[model samples]
Target: MASLKTTLVAATILVAVAGCAKKRPADLPPPPVDNSGPVDQGGATGPTTGAVVPGSDADFRRSVTSNTVRFGLDQYDIDPEARAILDSQSAWLQRYPNVRITIEGHCDERGTREYNLALGDRRANAAKNYLAARGVSPDRMTVISYGKERPEAMGSDDASWAQNRRAVTIVLS
Candidate 1:
């Protein structure tokens, strides 16, 4: 009787351990391998493998020189520098016909919310118009004004204010 009981207990323990083992399904594919080595940029490792995924934000950033444009104080006009940046962006947009984008306008924290909001709208529209004139479809883009609510820079100095007053383009697939 003792021998039979010991044999039963050993079998039960073996079954329990076997039940808890992790097993992958044989039909599932193996995980993708990363063949690209690490790239160093500004003390950070930027891993860029072959071919950016199509219609992706990474592709847009890789193809364009910049995704942002700066504005003068209380102004929304596209300067020469901004125009150059928009030209690159427009070219990238034309390449990816299916990708949609949103242009967000921002302002320095120096004006009332209402005034800043209005100014930001103008800035966003200015960028949109520039892109449209460069052959990108207006329907592919949307604009929003964040005004002083979302400042890129946190300080009140000239440099920070200048940095805060800008328009940023966001890629939305």
Candidate 2:
């Protein structure tokens, strides 16, 4: 009977320890949003026009030349994907003289607020430099860092962090 009690106690302790050892996974990124409208699919209306967007089936050149390209985590470095997208963006900027864009940088919730802010700025500046190097006027680009304040994804996992660490381009009026 004493042996049975010990065994029971041991099993109970094991269960408790196992329960405590379990880990929680971070939230994941959501499905892509359907960003339709005349403007999103390489087509634009009003004011600006005649910009080309590669890989788009729109009937005509987009009116404005604002294209957003996403990037990887912990990296302010511009990757091949980003470069291809920027190349297309540069073509558009070259076609249109008066268009200007703002690069908004964002980071995940893993770092300190100030650190994230600076990191975000670095990311934005990295993108800005790339655009400038591509022959876009330095005066035509602006950079803003949102750090962790604005999230493209709210998950605590790598997937969410990947989504969060991005530089988005918004057209400036």
Candidate 3:
């Protein structure tokens, strides 16, 4: 009777341990290859083969001339410099039709939260409108206002304030 009981206990533990074993999943296929060549906003081409994935943030930053545009103090207008940057961004968007983006408007630390939020909205919308006018579909872009909550530069000086007041474009796949 003792021998039979010991055998039964060992069998139960072995079965439990075997049931807890991890199972391996089937292997997945490799990602598709892109044969198209790399092109810049200026119509210039670069090395055809690289590790930069398409519709990725790295690709967007590498392809566009500039992703962030600065604004004047208490202003949200698209100046000549900002316009040029947006032009390049629009071209990049045109190239990647499926990639969506978010334009974030920011403000200096001097303004009230409410005022800064409103100003930020205006800045973001200004950028979105510029891209839309350049033939980018409005549906592919989103606008957001960070106000003074997120600052690019940290300081009370002119340089920090100048850097803080801007609009930034983020690539969203």
TM-score, one value per model: 0.71, 0.63, 0.71
lDDT of 2: 0.71
The digit string of per-residue lDDT tens for model 3 on 5-65 reads 9999999999999999999988653222221334233222235754567667667778787
Clashes of each: 0, 3, 0
Give the lowest summed-lDDT range of ten residues in model 3: 30-39
Q: Could you tell me which residue pairs clash in candidate 3? A: none
Alpha-carbon RMSD to native, per candidate? 13.5, 13.0, 11.2
State how far residue 91 of model 2 sits from its true place (Å).
0.8
TM-score for predicted model 3 compared with the true structure? 0.71
Instruction: Evaluate model 3: give its lDDT.
Output: 0.83
**Model 1, 1-173: lDDT tens per residue?**
99999999999999999999999867742222121323222223234644456656666666687778999999999999999999999988988888899888889999899999999999999999999999999999999888898877789999999998988887764
Q: Which scores greater on lDDT, model 2 or model 3?
A: 3
For lDDT, the strongest prediction is: 3
Off by over 4 Å in 1: 1-51
Q: Which is the better candidate, 2 or 3, if ranked by TM-score?
A: 3
